[model samples]
Target: MPLPSKRYVKVNVSQQFNYHTEAFNHLVKMLYPKRNTINKYDYLIDKHAFFTESQKQVISKTASSLCMLSEFYRDQDKFGNLYVTREDICNAIHILQRELDLQNRSLLLPPVLKWYAMQIQYHFGSDPFTLKQLRLQLGKSKSRVYDAVRELEHQKIVKLVGQRGHAHVFELVEHI
Candidate 1:
């Protein structure tokens, strides 16, 4: 991806209609493997005449990685969140706060450390943090993650179980 533009530029009304619709559609297909509907994303694009589908999909996927997929779909099927109970929000907040406190107890972490840790925990199942798989899920650079892992190890938060190719399989150090 190109380093994103630093500033938003003024867009003309005529320009919205002139955008490469097919190109945008292709971008959508490239960006989202599971997102079938373009309606919501299209509105964001047409309104602002800024931001690409890739950026939106990355943001969406990152959040989706945190929450269950069927959840968003379920919310959509029920039509907006007119029925979300206070209990639900409270339960969610409790979980989030607990995770935050746990993370704080473990030494300083990278920007997305907690989110990535949760992702690793979810996907790892019986196993955890194979570097190749983690790298793929990370969806970004590897050397950086290696550095983060080293820091994590120094904090005694994670340890290696084995290696696949150049990537080491990892397991969290603290156990219940």
Candidate 2:
């Protein structure tokens, strides 16, 4: 049998205004794959029912800011695959929250403390952890980790729980 001529048709798959919701949802999924995280975002959005349109727009802008921050903090492996840890998401959220906090003009935590907070949230959840463990995990000097821990304590983000030998045990006041 004679072969038929081959043909190709190009379909545009670019995002459009009509696909805004889908795109937003996809971005949310990418940033927060966990059901609990998605629920948190949904709850925040649901609370905007009484907010003015401008305020709602600010929330959308914060979401975009989070996406950008997440990309900035993403790590890459030797194989070129990207990795976004819970720490990265937490850091992004903290940055966005600081930017959006009009009433509380307090400075955001230093990068080291932000990193520590995320690590605590990721590794220990609400449980207590020792400074020694954090130092080992971060591969930082003892003094450096101690200073960061002190800063966290000063900010009321973490509370000193107890002491084990020379190491100080602390627990997160709330998940960052």
Candidate 3:
């Protein structure tokens, strides 16, 4: 009789899994390609002069906590695809705010203002931005975004640089 043929098992190969920490590390590397020697947070704080030292520390801690919480509660679907919804992010922010309140500390800036500052710093950086651009990015009413921008300008965090067509152009103040 011929020897029984061996059956070979086929293994399914999938794309490599991406963890939140790895994604964060990759982002840091991309943001600071040539400054590997310096701490990323410190470099970012130094680069953005609008935030006070206390605000910087608070923002950093809050961001780290949010990332941790988001990762902990990350969802996976039937296909093993990892994802986070807008609701998840909002919940995380609410939890973080409650925790801070319980600890007798509050976010240094108003929620809207803080969010606006972060959006500007991360997206627009030193580049000039218009109210229309901000409104489109934030999905807020033109008046609401204008008010927030006015508040930021009052705080000396941003300056009215010029006008672009019918919209007013603003740029983050390099120094307070």
Candidate 4:
């Protein structure tokens, strides 16, 4: 007998219904082969049959959200190269969530100080900015800006630079 042709059969997996079950069914059929029968689609689906219900759910959700046949599927770019991988997107999301958590945790400061911190990050980032310019740009009063900047300095998120007359220059500190 000749070798079996490896081909995947198109199965309609809907987002509204049991897409998780359908995907697992396909994966199961691929994992265990009949003794005398040739299973062609085995190569298409993932051979890992040791996944738990939760892991399977994660894969199914990822695949459906990404609009792919399975989580093991590799999407190609316009240049015919391997583009966005499932693991890549997951890693990016994890990183973004960590960043968000960091930002949220740093919100222990007052509301005005928090706003000032975000504004500083947006406007100057790591660069030095003058208090006069910040007050003018943010359209806030001089005393309010002064108080917020003082609170930020107290939190060690920013540090004062060289004093230019009554106006002070400051820059964001490291690791913030």
Q: What's the TM-score of each model vs. the native?
A: 0.34, 0.39, 0.38, 0.38
| C-alpha local distance difference test of each model | 0.48, 0.59, 0.58, 0.55
lDDT of 4 by residue, 79-130 (tens): 4333334453343333222222233334345566677888988888998888
Alpha-carbon error at 14 in model 1, in Å? 68
**Strongest candidate by lDDT:** 2
lDDT, model 3: 0.58
Candidate with more favorable, higher lDDT: 1 or 3: 3
Return the lDDT, model 2, position 169.
92
Model 4 misplaced stretches (Cα beyond 4 Å): 1-105, 174-176
Write model 1 residue lDDT over 133-155, tens digit each, in one string.
76787775787677766766655
Deviation in Å, model 3, residue 116 alpha carbon: 0.6
- Which runs of model 1 end up more than 4 angstroms from their true locations? 1-104, 107-111
lDDT of 2: 0.59
Candidate 3 vs candidate 4, lDDT winner: 3
- Residue 35 error, candidate 1, Å: 63
- Over 4 Å off in model 3, which ranges? 1-108, 174-176
